[model samples]
Target chain A: MDKVIIAQNLSLAYSKDETIINKANFSIDSGSFVFVTGASGSGKSTLLKSLYGALKPIEGSLVVGGVELCGISSKKLNFLRRHLGIVFQDYKLVKEWTIEKNIMLPLIINGYEKSITQSQVDSLLKHVKLQHQAGKYPLELSGGEQQRVAMARALAHNPILILADEPTGNLDDYSSQLIWNLLEGAHEQLKTTVIVVTHHIPETIKIDYKHYHIEFGDIHEVV
Target chain B: MKSFKNHISLVIALVSILFSLQVFTIVERSIDAYKENLAQNYSLVVVSQKTLQKKELLDKITTLASIEQLSPDNVIKKLNTGISKKNKELLKVTLPKFYKLQLKIYPTPLQLQRLQKELLRYPYIVKVETFSNTHDTTYKLLLLFKNVIFILSLSIVLVTILLIFKELRIWQFKHNERMSIMGLFGAPAWLRSAVLFRLAIVDALIAFGISFVIFSYFSSSAWVSEQFANIGISVIVFDKVYDSLIMLGVSMTVSVLLASFIVLGHKEEV
Candidate 1:
């Protein structure tokens, strides 16, 4: 399988004096589901941010979807991000927009036709079991519903890679299981590579998957 | 509702500024016309011992438009109340010749005084009366009025610009979250700022429409006509198509420019 992401001697930081991820090396294969486990403030989120070009690699090379992100131009970074889907812990839905419109955001940004976007959004709403809440605003939805909406939004454009940061960190057991099932379904059925950062790794996941644990600014693949 | 309120405040500010601009233009034009009328009606009276030719006065004072010889019949009649016919005729022959010297335009106080001195240089000319006191007072009053309007218009322009900028900044803050999310989704700068542009354009159009109605009514009102008549000058308060187009252009340019400023500022911060 082709590698979708490759990082060699990568170091991440917000400023010059404070490094988050130091000398880390990793590669993620296409169509693979991977879990990054770490303690609080162990730079799991920083690693994910680096993958999306939000933070630059401080020391070495990092590439995602055939684009080098170390010193990417804004044009190049935006182009690379077009093929990526990202989900945040807070859901990050636009409060003034309806649930359906929120899900249609990525498709609209990608310049999809209105008819196609509407059909895809309808299908995603059904998949997320929020078809009845399509017209409601994000503020009107519950936490679990909002997260589901965010998931639908992330998958709206059918991106090749999905980066989820603590997607189930604040959800109840039922919502967490639902989000896990959705992520697993996308990886298996759509052949999409997914990288999730979380403190908990459910033991009942029955799939061919990889695990990388971060400890004290170091990342290692766990057998 | 809050958005509507914000838009209304901006529209009101823009309309007041645009209206003040139109009023300034009209008042300036009216003052110019009034001064032209005054210049046409004014003339300097010169008394000479010998009858003077119009060409001679014109040559002496380059500013002179034309000079008319005043008949001595009125002066002789006023003095003939008790005198005999022969004495009245004798008094007319002894009186000096009077000429009215008209000018091309209204003269300043200094120009009037200079003309008086130039006319007095001739050995035949005896006295020159320019009526300088009344003319000088009227000229000063017109200048003071123009300065007051100019300062008022300038103040309105500065205040309106600050108000528009503040309102646009508030709108930017309100939409910042949505715009940032859109930006994270690989949306371009134009796409992220589409909503702000729409808001600015709509509010500008609304202000233009309101101004159009108010000015149209004022332009045709009887009170405005009466005021112009009192001053003996007909002024145009507004032009339907030409003025509207100008106001529309100004309103849109200001709105769009301010909106673009906010968007660029937000982009820089990001």
Candidate 2:
């Protein structure tokens, strides 16, 4: 399998003299479900940010979806981000837009036809079980429902890689299970690579997956 | 209510700026037309020691429109009636030539001085009366009026632009979150700030419409027509088609440019 993400001596920092994720080396295979576990402030979120091009590497090489992210121009990074779906912990939905419009964001940015985008949004609404709430705004939805909307949005574009930064971190047990099922289902059905960063991994997941734990600013795979 | 407030603020600023511009244009046109009227009635009296040829005078002074010889019979009649008819004839023959010089356009004070110097360069053309006292007073007053209007209009435009820019910046702040979210989704800069552009364009159109109606009404008013009649000059206060196009262009350009500034500033902050 081809590697979707490759990091050799990747170091990420918000500023100089304050390195967050130290010279970490890792490679995530295509169509694999991987969990990055770490304690609070262990640079788990920073590592995920580097993968999605939100944070650039201060020292070494970090590539995602076959594009080198270190020193990448904003224009090129934006183009690369179009093919990758990202879900944030806070559910960064445009509050003024309706749920349908929020889910349609990725498709609209990709320049998909309006008719096709509408149908895809409709289908995703049904899949996410928010079909009845398509016209409501993000604030009108509950936390779980909003996260489900975020999940639906992340999976809407059929991206090659999906990066979730604590997607289910603030959700209830049932909501967390629902999010996990979506990630697993995407990997199985669409053959998409999934990288999720969280403090704990739910043992209920039955699929074969790889685990990488972050400790002492280094990422180590756990057998 | 908040959106209405925003629209009203921008419209008010734009209307004030457009009003100042219209007033400036009207005042300028009126002054120019008045000057033309004055120039038509004004003439220079030139006394020459030798007979002055019309073609020669025109060639010497390019601004000379027409030169008509002043009949010396009237001045001669006012002289002593006891003089013999032959003496009168001799006096007329020996008298210097008198010519009225009318210019094609009104000359500025400096141009008038230059014309005087040019005319005096011919020794035979000794006495040239330009009526400098009256001409200076009228021309100076007209110039001062034009300069005052220009400075006032420029100041109003500058202040209104700053107000519009401030309003747009506030609007951008309100929409920053939405724009930032769109940015995260790989939306281009234009798409991210589409809302700002839309608001600016809509407000600009509204302002243009309001300004057009106001100017059109004022231009055709009876009072405005009477004022122009009193001044004895016909001035075009507004040209519906031409002025409308200019106003539209100016309002759109100002609003769009200010909105673009806000968008770019926000982008830099991000």
DockQ winner: 1
Docking class of 2: acceptable
Please give, for residues A36-99, the per-residue lDDT of candidate 2 as tens digits.
9989999998898888777778899998989999888878887887888889999988887899
Per-residue lDDT of model 1, residues B1-270, tens digit only: 846786887798889878888888878978887887788889889999988867766886788999888999998877767899888878888999998889987888888888899889989999998988889999899889989998998898889888877887786787787887887788888888898899889989998999899999999999998998898888878989889999999899988887888787784222
Model 1 over residues A103-219: C-alpha lDDT tens digits? 999999999999999999999999888999999999998898999999999999999999999998888877778788889989999999999999988876777889999998899
Go through the candidates in order and give the C-alpha RMSD of each one to the true structure: 3.2, 2.9
- The DockQ value obtained for model 2 is 0.44
Clashes, model 1: 0
Query: Each prediction's TM-score against the native?
Result: 0.88, 0.89
What is the Å distance of residue B90 in model 1 from its true position? 8.7
Candidate 1 interface RMSD (Å): 2.5
